[model samples]
Target: MRNTQQRKTEWLNIQWKGGVMTHPVQQDGSSCGVIVVLMAREIMKAFPNVPILQFGTSRKEMANERKMMALQILKASVFDEAENCSMCSLKKPTGSVHRFINWIQCDTCERWYHEKCLGMAKEDLEQARANTWSCILCS
Candidate 1:
């Protein structure tokens, strides 16, 4: 197993280059690799164990899948955090102790939610441990 930090770097170093990312870019290379690596670090920290599927034999397919996986990871992390927000209650009286979750997001699709409107439990939402949480729509 690769070190977590190095693993992240290696994954992000991959890029779409003339339909193949195996070769390093000789020009404008340093910036793109660094940017992607940093983005990967943020995404991996936010979402763990996101599936990366590549069915086609082409390198393009592999590259696309990797990009999609990274996007999904970021989406998962965003949704996981949004589900716990407690600002969604519209009918609650002002100065209420309970902070309603106003912006809940679907873990699969990245759809936003209004807690009360979406009929989700605050406790249940807050108790979610993984970024793979699914919303009612996705479920």
Candidate 2:
């Protein structure tokens, strides 16, 4: 028999308001699990009702803290730290010079990450490759 009494925290909305940009809640950004949508799916499997909370802050102090944390994480992003490669930095003109097509190369693998795609950081990706590592998605 399964224990229905044990309640789990499932849904989380992480709203970030930076300068002029705000990214809505996302599961991956919170480091909670795989895709954010999957969190809802998993919760549905175990319980009918799930508790959700919005992370970060409504107050200035908390907001500052949240911003700092975000800065730290972003600083370590592959775009900032990884070595640039040809395939990673090419762009196609869109209007007069090419406005619609911009391409990015993977820091570790040197493959292309298109306008709407994201990839693992080169350092982490390289470490994984060297250690024979595979993530859940890869595995």
Best by TM-score: 1
TM-score of each: 0.26, 0.20
lDDT to native, each model: 0.51, 0.45
lDDT of 2: 0.45
Clashes of each: 9, 8
Q: Give the lDDT of residue 52 in candidate 2.
A: 51
Q: What does candidate 2 score on TM?
A: 0.20
The CA lDDT at 8 in model 2 is: 42
Q: Model 2: residues >4 Å from true position, as ranges?
A: 1-58, 81-139
User: What's the TM for model 1?
Assistant: 0.26
**Which pairs of residues have clashing backbones in candidate 1?**
86-99, 86-100, 86-101, 87-100, 87-101, 87-102, 88-100, 88-101, 88-102
Give the lDDT of residue 23 in candidate 1.
Answer: 33
Model 2 clashing residue pairs (backbone): 88-105, 93-97, 93-98, 93-99, 94-98, 94-99, 94-100, 95-99
